[model samples]
Target: MRITNGAGLPAINEAPGAQIAEGPAIVPRSASAVRPAGDATTLRLSHAEMQKLPDVDSERVADIKAALLDGTIVFDASSLAARIARYHGGPQ
Candidate 1:
């Protein structure tokens, strides 16, 4: 999705390790000069970088799902109600 500034110009979205041009000429303050039509840039994460991320604990997720199914997961009803009331600007 493209984000626009107050002038409806496409916002500059920079990525890490990306080379950004220095000087006012390259980085224009005006909306029209920022990016012309047909100019598209894509950002992607490398496979090695993606591999550095942590894996989800499937066993723990399964346990939580089972607990939820059997209604064994405990919840504070009064606390939840108070939060709901606060969110709705009602009396706690």
Candidate 2:
């Protein structure tokens, strides 16, 4: 069911000023904390670099390269741990 404002208890905004003591004063935010919207930089590959690379049409290679460039590609910790376990065989 759709219920409008003041359906139950008294509306907060409509309440008396004495009932609502002033809340914590808001401190003005510093300029440094607010970053500009147009301040961001865009990344691009050089034309010469792109020309040097072959198979640009390959989706798999392009995806891998994009992931690496964006720092999304990470080392497989579980695989590394298993490999290390196999190499060590036992505790030192």
Q: TM-scores for all candidates?
A: 0.28, 0.22
Worst 10 residues of 2 by lDDT: 38-47
Misplaced by over 4 Å in model 2 are 1-4, 11-19, 23-28, 36-38, 42-92
* lDDT by residue (tens digit), candidate 1, 1-92: 33457986545674566666655655447886576543442223455576776698788999998998898997779999999999999995
lDDT by residue for model 2 (1-92), tens: 22247568655556365454465667678998986764443223455566788766598888998998898997689888888988889532
Stretches of candidate 1 exceeding 4 Å from the true structure: 1-29, 32-62, 68-72
**Candidate number achieving the greatest TM-score relative to the actual structure:** 1
Per-candidate local distance difference test: 0.71, 0.67
Q: Which whole-number lDDT from 0 to 100 does residue 52 have in model 2? A: 80
Q: Candidate 2 clashing pairs?
A: none
